[model samples]
Target: MRYSVSEWTKSGSPWVWLNAGAVAICVIMVVGLLGLIAMRGLAHFWPADVMQATYTQGDQSRRIMGELVQQEMVPAEQLRGAGIQVPDGVEEMRRDLLKVGNRDFSSADFVWAMDQGISDKTLPEMIMVAERLEWGNFYGYLREVRESGETVARHDGHAKSPEYLAVWDEFQRRIDRVLEIRDQILTIEKHEIGSINYELERLRLEERSLELEQSTDAEAYAEIEARRAELNADYEVLQQDLIDLYTKINRDSFTAEIADGREVEIDIAKVVRAFLPNKMGTGEKMAHYGVKLWEFLSDEPREANTEGGIFPAIFGTVMMVILMSVLVTPFGVIAAVYLREYATQGFITRLIRIAVNNLAGVPSIVYGVFGLGFFVYFLGGSIDDLFFPEAKPAPTFGTGGLMWASITLALLTVPVVIVATEEGLARIPRSVREGSLALGATKFETLMKVVLPMASPAMMTGVILAIARAAGEVAPLMLVGVVKLAPSLPLDGNYPFLHLDQKFMHLGFHIYDVGFQSPNVEAARPLVYATAFLLVVVIALLNFSAIAIRNHLREKYKALEM
Candidate 1:
């Protein structure tokens, strides 16, 4: 209790406290960041109350309706600079960013309104927000429901009369039917017809290959023609089915009065969801939130990735990471084994180790460039020239793709694995190896049966590190394979099941694109946060899986280490 400063220092209590404090600060920062992300991103799914008001600017007045997005107080000088008139006495003004959709009619999907100029603000239960397949959301008052250009039901003004209720019911039923039709169309187009097209392409490639080889087999040519004919027949049938589905989906339409007081006819097929947020109770809002969140996760992105789901990006990110893991582990482990167990520990070996360490420090973008040049262009182009000459001019493997992206990331993160494995190998007691050697075991046998099993936990540690780095990497992937939108997933029900040559979407790249490159910045802001949080969750899941395996291996080998 009476220890001097020197004694306290010597006891290491100060250092321990400092270290613990640092760790605590780090944990707090991480949790805080994640909390912020979750709040901003996940809240986008919640149905906020929509507001209707009359907004006046100078001598002009107009009706405005939208969900209140954000509000901030700005200096009067800033408003004046932006050509907004403020009363002389006012030093500051509150500006509100409202997501007034109906993008087709309005020049902007979001608008900044001066709070002082807004009056008669009300949440009208009759107001409907239509989530659409195109042109963003449509916020308005439902006026009429029509079938095949004939009015089925109509409402007067913003009244929720019996006629309006009937119209609403009919609209909901039609939406459900259209959604079912849309699913069938998607299945036909993406799966059934898609498979047929793939087969047809393969047949064409086979014929080209035969021609390239100068094969004069008449039967082979006939067989290819026969397959093509069959595929064409199936395609025609699917095309007819799609046409019918489209006609059915497009048959119903509704008219809505937007904020500008113009009634526009919208096809039911374009409407993804229509909801009256003002009328919704807590339970209904929660259900709606769940549905919206699920759609964000499971639906394909629309409106330039500002709307819809990120499922494709999620799939691509996971697939590429998995591929990278598979490719990096063996190479890294082998290199570590050779360096630690077999190679002479000479000057050259020391240089190699230094080089490996340096490689880990190299800029990730540099790896991306190298990947683009060597992996995508040189190696892939060579393979294409040799094996796919028939598909020339299209580039095929010579272009950025899932395989090349994975390979590039593997190269980028392999140094981590090598270093980790070497450290693990160094920690293995020499006596353990000697004991195995003394017990009639060859060097290889001892390494395989004893040393490797003990070092596996470390190998997994390396893999977890690799996964964390590779999963979040966006730069290299952009150059190698990641795209703003991928037409089809790399993995599908095709013949090969996994198409490594296909380009793919990635969450990291998606966040960058949506956050920085989107035309609708306000609309895309929440999505960027949501996507970043999802990416964090995905990386956490992958790391947790690797950690579990590492823990199991560590537990299994605890006795050996002892």
Candidate 2:
């Protein structure tokens, strides 16, 4: 009853099964990868109990305290090769990765401790984890809370001590106040006084422009000076306000005992957050997790992007893709329309179609090189020289920036749009065009009114494909406009809010930086997973929006279809 290969092919059942299996495999792989990323990334925000343990090595014992990161069993041969003594009968040695914070005091923030050598492990309910602004986290016992060198709340690291609760309440209040004042200072520095500084610079540039033109009239000079005076006055007031706020913030301090029995005084202003994870209930832990997750999403990164939120990267990535979409759509649609509708059927047109297809196959790095050479250097340099000569020797548009990145991505993805759009235009019925012409509509009107409306869904399809490609591109962005860290966002409250020439961060570049470029690879690993998950979500959202528009257009033009 066995069938021949030709008979099986003729039946088509084998091919159909093959296709279904392939699709299932592909889907499973995608889901598995995403699940792994989520497990690693999202677990970083959860509050884990601090283990205060005694770690012994070579006849020396030291107190070690931090989060238990991971555990593994390693072959005895491996440990012996690394100069560690192992028992003769033991086949393997157990090791635990401990996140021993206080990087400032220790050589490393994370270390591997042999389970055989470690003893006296305890989870102390009074142990506190202080997330600081620098040097990563600090794990210790809260000692004394002070204000202006006067003891306010003192604790002896006892679970039944009321002083610990008082200290916690007072510290929480001060932290809230510090955060409020910090925001005020940031607003003034980055926006209020920032606006003044920007205006002053603009005035200086204007004066220089006038001087270059040999038109530095007395009246014009006086007007510029007047504006400068106003800006300076505003800056003085803001400077005083900052000084007062700084004084207020530094007035509170606390002392905490580290794992090694030394108490260190920490300024309240330096503490980003303080939490007692061992004392928290399930509901409290969940609430804390939610807050931490929110902070990761909304706060600007600190400590080399291993800490804080990735809002800037998220914003920059979305902004760049939107700009790329805006630039690619019209150019691709117009080129496609000409090729499909207006151009005579000829060899040259066919060659253009071939070239467009070939462009899609080119490596993204090649596009990056072209963008760097032609867009950033050649075209942008010429623009800066012609229009921004007053700021010579300092590049304005003649450097990697947001606009150049968008344009580079648009150039890279235009081929997809053109191909999709041409296919869409080809699907239109010949009678639809003839009918519009018969009704006295010009060729342009027919394209604008009848043909394009029916082709709207296709344009959106092209845009979706373009966005999908552009959002994930990291190599070209690195060469053109993406940076390790941008001090300011491209869009801010400054005058002429959208500054196209400013450099920006991107999620793709951020992932590369954190995963590969970070000094603390262990600390940064979870962030890599989290950032990757977020990037996938962003791409999905962008595609969904385009798909929604395409669906609407398809329904509207259903009557026009043949």
The numbered model that scores best in TM-score is 1
Instruction: Give the Cα-based TM-score of candidate 1 against the true structure.
Output: 0.98
Model 2 residue 459 lDDT score? 95
Stretch of 10 with least lDDT, candidate 1: 156-165
Report the lDDT of model 1 for residue 340.
Answer: 98
**Model 2 weakest 10-residue run by lDDT:** 154-163
Encode model 2's per-residue lDDT on 353-410: one tens digit a residue: 9999999999999999999999999999999999999887888999999999999999
lDDT (tens digit, per residue) of candidate 1 on 1-562: 5999999999999999999999999999999999999999999999999999999988999999999999999999998899998888999989899999988997998999889899999999899999998899899999888999999888876966777788888889989998999999999988998889899989988999999999999999999999899889989989999999888998999998999889999999999989899999999999999999999998899999999999999999999999999999999999999999999999999999999999999989999999999999999999999999988778889999999999999999999999999999999999999999999999999999999999999999999999999999998888998999999999888878999999999999999999999998999999999999999999999999999999999999999999
| C-alpha TM-scores of all predictions | 0.98, 0.96
